[model samples]
Target: MPHHDGEQNGRGLSFAKRIYLPRTIGLSVGSVCVAVALYPLPWMHWIWAMLVMHAWVWPHLAYQRARRSSNPYKAELQNMLGDSFAGGIWVALMGFSALPSVAILAMMAMQNIAANGLRLLWQGLLANLLGAVLGFVLFTPQIQLASTPEEIYACLPLLVIYPAFIGWMGYKVALKLSEHKHVLSRLSRTDSLTGLINHGTWKDLLQVEFTRSQTLNRACCVALIDIDHFKTINDRYGHIVGDSVLKALSQALRDNIRASDLAGRYGGDELCVILPNTDLDLAVGILERLRQIVENQVDALLPELRISLSIGVAPYEQHIVDAASWLNEADKALYGAKSTGRNRVVSAPCTRADFQGLALGV
Candidate 1:
C-alpha cells in the first residue's frame, strides 16, 4: 500500500490540502441530502445540531487537525476513515433511505480508492460497516429503503458533481505522472554535465543512422572532436575551469550545428556529432565554425581560459562496411589533426581500397 510522495512523512500540509476541498464539497452537498431525507422524521434536536456541525464545521476542523499533526499524511488518512464512519452513521440516521445512503457510500469508496488504492478502500468499508452497526444498536434506527423524490433530488449533486470532480483530479495526477516520465526518459539518455546525448545513446543513434543512410543512399557524416591540451589546462587551472572549457565547446556545437545534427559527449575531453544529410565538406564547415566559436567566445566568457578544438570528420562511403569502420576513419582524421596542429579540422575520405586496407589491417 505505497502512497504518493506528498503522502510521505513530514509532507502533512500537502496531503491535508489535497483532501480538504474535496471533503468540504462532499460533506456540504451530503449534508443537504441527509437533512432533506430526515426532515419528516421526529429525531432529537441535538441530532439536527450534530448534522449542522458535521456539515458546516467538520471540514475546516479536520484540515487544521491534520495540518497541526506530527504526520499530516497519516492524520489525513485517519480523517478519511472518520469520514467513512460518519457516512455510515448518516445512512443509519436517514433510516437507510436508498439514494442518499448510496451516494454517501459511493463517494466514500471513490475517495478511499483514490487515496491509497484497494487497501484503503477495504479499510474504509470496514469503518463504514462498524459505524452502521453501532448506530443501529444504539439508536434502533428504522430501516426505510424507499427515498422521497425530494431526497433523491438532494442526492443528485453529490452523485453527479463529486464524481466528476474526482475524475478531474485523477486526470491531473495522470498528466503530472506523464510529465515526470518524460523528464526521466530525457535525463537517462543525456549527459548531466554537457546536457548533450550521452555516449551510449549517441552510439545507438549512430547505428540507426548508419542503417538509414545505407537504405536511403543519403549523405551523412560523423565528427570526433577533442579538446586541445585539455589535460594541461586541467593541470594548470583545476577541474572547475576544465569543466567550463568542456561546457563552452558543447555550447558552441549546439549554437553552430543544424537542428538535425546530434552532438554528444563521447568521453573525457572528447565529444562527437552525427550530421545527417551532410557530406564531408558540410561537416567540416560546421566543425570549423564550432572550433572558431570556442576559440573566440571562451576567453570572453571565462577570462582565465583560452580554448581550441581538434576535429576529425568522415562522410558515409558506400565501401564502408559498418558504423565502427566509419567512426574509425573519423578517429584517424582526429588523430591526424591533433598530431599536426591543435586547432584544425581534418576530413578522412574512405575509398573501397581504404576500407579493404582497414579491414585487412594493412
Candidate 2:
C-alpha cells in the first residue's frame, strides 16, 4: 500500500511541475513588459500594449509562487494586490505615461472575475477598482500639466484599468499554482495503500517525537508488531489473500489506536506503532488489545485461518538518546516474543546487565 501511494505522489508532483512551467513562462513575459515600459523610447503605443500584456500575465506568476509555497488563496490575494500597487506606482513614476489603456485593463479584471470563483472575483474587483480610482486621482493632474486633453484622454483608460486588471490576473494565477503544489505535497507524505504515513514518514515522525520526549522528559513507547505466520498464509492462500490480511490488520490497528499514535507498515509482514507519552505498561496493554482485535477480525475474512501478532515494546529513557537505538530495543523484545512462541507481548529489558546475558539481536 505504501508503494502504491508513493507512485501516486510521484505522479502528482509530475503534474504540478507541468502546471508550474507555463506559469514561469508567463511571469518571464510580464517581466519583459515591465522592462519595456521603463525604457525611454517613442513607443507609447507599444508601451501601452506591453502594459496590457503584463497585466494579463502578472496574476499567474503570483498563483504559481503561491502553489510552490503551498498557500494558494493568500498567494492569489497578494498577487492581485501587488499587481495593482505596482501599476499604480509605475504610472506615478512614468508621469502617468500609460493612462489610455483602461479598456484592456477592465477586460483583464473581468477575466480574473470569471476564472476565479465569484467570491474571489468580487474581492479582486473591489481591490482593483480602488486602485484604478486612486491611479486616476494621483496621475491625471500630472497628465494635464505635461500633455493635451486628447493625449491625457488617450492615456486615461490605461491608468484606470491597468492596476485593477493586473491585480485580478495575479490572483487567478496564484490560486491554480497553489492547488497543484498542495496536491503534490499531500501525495508525497501519504502512503498509497491505507492512506497512512509511509515508512520514511514514520521514521521522520519518530525522530520528532524522540526530540520532544527528550526535551520534555516525557515517556514514549515504540512497538514492533509482526503478523504471525504471514509467509505460510501467503503461500497457501495466494498473494491476494495476503494483501487482504495486511489491509484488514492495518485497519484494525488504526481503529484501535489513538489519534496521536503513529502506525505504519514497516515492510511486508511487519508494522510499527509509536505511542507518544506512553510508558511500557500502557503500550503493552494497547498491543494486547490490538492482538485480540487482529485475531477476531482475521476470522471474518478467513474463518479457517488463524492469524496472530507478536508485539515487543520498549520505553524511551534518558539513556536512550537516538530513535534507532530505541527501535532496536523494541525489535529485540519482538524477536524474543516470537521465539518464545508467537502471539505474545515482550517488554524490553531496561538494564544493560539484563541485555548482556541474553543473546538477543534486534
Candidate 3:
C-alpha cells in the first residue's frame, strides 16, 4: 500500500525549522533520560555515547540531509522514520522500563500525528517495532516493567516540559497556516492592478446575483463602465501614468459605491458593477454622479492629464433568461454610450427576443 508521509513539497523550509528541529531536540533529550534510567550497567558507557550521538549529533545530520536533498520533503520524512527507529533502540536499552518507555512511545506518536496525521503514526510505529527487535538481538533487554523511583523522577521533566513545548509549537503552526490560507484566498479573488475583484470572481458573483434577482423577482441592475481614450493616455503619457489613472478610477469606485454593491474589473479598461434591487433610472442617477465625481477627482489630482468615462446600465429583466444575456444587454448599452459620446451613460434600448445562440451559455 502507498503511504502519505509528510513529504508535502510546499511545506519545505517551514516544516523543517519549526517542526522537525524541535522534535529532534525532544527525542534527543528524552533518549538521555532513558539512558540514565539504565545507570551503571556494564554497557552504560556505550549507551551514554549513543545517547549523546542521537541527541546532539543526529539532529544536525538529519537537518543537513533534508536541506541538501533534491526532494527536501521526502528526506525529512525519512529522517522522522529514523527518529522512530532511534527511539525504539533507546527503549530497549532502558530494558523497556515502564516510565521512560511509555514516555518515548507517547512523544513519538505525538510527533507523528502532528506531522501528517494517522498514516505517518502507523509508519513510525512499525519502525519502532523493528528497531526494538534489533535492540533485543544486540543487547538483550532486561525487561524492567516497574521503574525505581529515581528512574521515574528522571523521566518526569522530559515527559512534562516536552509535551507542553511541542503543544505550543503546534498551536503556532496552526495560526500561521490559517493566516497563509486567508491571504491566498484573497489573492485568488482580487485583481492585482486595481484592488477590485478579478474577472472570474466577479463573473461567479454575477451568477449568484442573477439567481437571487430571478428567484425573488427583484429589480437588479448591471453597469458596464469603460475608461474613455485609455489607449491615447498610454500613448501620450506612457503606461505608468495610465496605471495612475486606473488607480484613481478604482479609488473613486470604491469610495462612491455602497458596501452591498459589487464592483469589479471586467478586463483591461472596462469595470463593471452589480446593483441589487435597483431600477435603471436610479442606477443611471448613481452612475451619473459617479461620472462627475471621477472626472472632478482626476481633474483635481492630475490637472495636466484629462480622462473621462463611458458607462452603460442594464436592468435585469424577467425576460432575460441567463447571466450571459444580462451581461450582453449591459455591454450593448456601454457600446451605445461610447458611440453617442465619449463621456456619458446609456441604457440598453430594450430586451431582445433573439436569445437563442446566447441563451445556451446560461
Candidate 4:
C-alpha cells in the first residue's frame, strides 16, 4: 500500500530548494560566463538586453511561487505566466543560437523562463523553433562563404537536428521532475494500514470543507465512527488480523460513501466521514447502510465476531458553525451511542440554549 503525507501546497519547500539550488547556481555561473564572453558588446546593450528578457520573466516567477502557495488567482496567473514565459524562452534561445558571445546570457534567460513554464508544451515548441531560426541565421555567414557545396551541405544536419534534440531532453527532464513531485505528494497524505486519509490529512480537508461550506452556504455533514470491541479483536486474533479488519473496513467505508464524501482514519479504531452537500438525515442514512454492510461481512467471516459500530452524525452550519466544534459534537454523540451499547447511529446533542424554554409540560 502507498503512504501519503498530509496535503500542503508548498510543504516540500526544503526538498524543492535542495533540488533547485544546484540548478540555480549552475545557471548563474553559466550566465556570468556569457556576460564575460559578450564583453566586446557595449555594456549598455548587454544590460538593456538582460533587462528586457528579465522583464518578461520575473512576474512569471512571482506568479508561479504565489500559485504554489495557494493564491486565489493561481489559475489565471498560471495561464498568463505560462504563455509569457514560453515566448520569452523561445526568443532568448534564438538570440543565444544567433550570438554565441551572448549565449550564456541567453541561456540564463531561457532557464528562468523554463523553470516557471516548462509544463506548457506548446510554449516549449515555440521556444525551440525560435532557437532553430536563430541558429540558422547566426551560422549563415559561414555557410555562404563555404568553398565547396559539401561544406554548406554538412551544416544542414546541425540546423535541423540540434534544437529538436534539446527540446526532447527538456521534455524528458520535466517529466522526471513531475513524477518525483507526485511521489512526494502521495507520501504525505495517505495512511498505510487502512489505505485512507490519515488524521492530519483529515483535519486539513475538514478545514477546507468548512470554509467552503460557510462561504457558499452549502450543507455538509460529519460522521464519527468507532469500531466496537476493536481492542478485543486485536487481543483475540493477533494484531495482523486486526489490521486486516481495519483495512477491509476502510475500503467498505470508501465504497459506500458518495464521491464527494471523504473518509479518513482518525485514530485507533476511529474513522471519520465528511459528507459535502449532505444533511444530517442523509448522513445518518448512509452510515446506517454502511454499518449493516460491515455487520453482514463480519458475521459471515467470523460467525462469532461481534463487531459493530457506533456512529455520530452532525450537519454543518445547522449543527455547529466551525470544524472543531462540529467534530466535537459528533464525537460526543459517538460516545453517547457507545455508552448506550454500540451498533447504532446518534444525532449530535443540542446545547440547552438550543432547547430554548420549551419544557415537557406533562
User: Whose lDDT is greatest here?
Assistant: 1
Rank the candidate models, highest lDDT first. 1, 3, 2, 4
Model 1 is weakest, by summed lDDT over 10 consecutive residues, at 350-359
For model 2, how does the per-residue alpha-carbon lDDT over 183-269 read when each residue is reduced to its tens digit? 988788767775667788888988999999999999999988998999999999999888878888888889999998999877778
What is candidate 4's lDDT per residue for 1-362, written digit by digit as tens? Answer: 12223233343443234224323333333333334333433345645476444444444454446446543233433443343343334334323333332333334334435444455444544544564466445433222211233323433443334334446657877898899999888778888888888999999999999898888889888889999989999999899878988888999899999898999999998999999989878888999999999888844666786567888887776546688998888887787667666788877765433323222221
182-267 in candidate 1: lDDT tens per residue? 99999999999999999999999999999999999999999999999999999998899889778877887898899999999999
For residue 344, what is the lDDT in candidate 1? 87
Greater-lDDT candidate between 1 and 3? 1
Off by over 4 Å in 2: 1-98, 101-169, 298-301, 350-362
Each candidate's TM vs. the true structure? 0.91, 0.56, 0.75, 0.57
Stronger candidate by TM-score (1 vs 3): 1
Per-residue lDDT of candidate 3, residues 1-362 (tens digit): 12333445445655666665676669667866776677745675667777788888888888887877766777888888999998888788778888888888889888888887899899999999988889988999777778888787878888887888888988887998899999999999999999999999999999999999999999889999999999999998899988888988988998888888999999999999999989888999989999998777636555788768999889999999999999999988887676665688888754333222233343
Q: How many backbone clashes does candidate 4 have?
A: 10
Model 3 lDDT, full chain set = 0.83
Backbone steric clashes in candidate 1, count: 0
- Give the lDDT of residue 327 in candidate 3: 94
